[model samples]
Target: MSFQNTASFPGAGIPEQVSFDRKELSVILSLYGRMVAAGEWRDYGISSLRECAVFSVFRRTAEHPLYRIEKRPKLRNRQGQYSVVGIDGQILKRGHDLKTVLRVLERKLIRAVD
Candidate 1:
């Protein structure tokens, strides 16, 4: 019995996990910082999955996220890779540009101030 070694190849048995890049995180964090200062958001979470990456914003630590920012590379060509989902699982915005997609949340921040 002979067994072939697969150790030579990196990520041979590893599943790919999608995540936000530095630039992407920069933009997201900028908004998060503003929200935090405004007292609109208090907690956040990040998740990296095989198909997509998610950044969840929470009003409180124990409750469900108020919004979810998702990056699905597979949708890059079809409906754009970036999307913002509301608490009720509705897509608020979707586009190729992260900043543009995140503008939906910014609008809420504006409303909170007034």
Candidate 2:
């Protein structure tokens, strides 16, 4: 009997586990870089899961994350794909355009130096 190839073949390259794209990453990193230099963020983590992709920012490696940038492709048509969540699990913003949604974080960067 001839052997049939299964869908989960060993040599098959698995698709991406997460949804965030290059343009999304550029926006996230752009803000992250500034926060890093400003001493507001010290570390970060990336998680690509079946449901969503997340970029978590932290003030320290061992502490809880300060913020999370998530891409939920499933929500693209309804609420949009990009979202920024706070440490308390509150959604700070959500939108189709990454740049616009990220503006909230930029606002945090502004301050008055006395």
Best by TM-score: 1
Overlapping backbone residue pairs in candidate 1 total: 0
Tens digit per residue, CA lDDT, model 1, 1-114: 999975677767665888999999999999999999989999999999999999999999999999999999989999999999999999999999999999988886766334
What residue pairs are clashing in model 1?
none
In terms of lDDT, the poorest run of 10 residues in model 2 is: 11-20
TM-scores of the models, in the order given: 0.85, 0.83
TM-score (C-alpha, index-matched) for candidate 1: 0.85
lDDT of prediction 1: 0.94
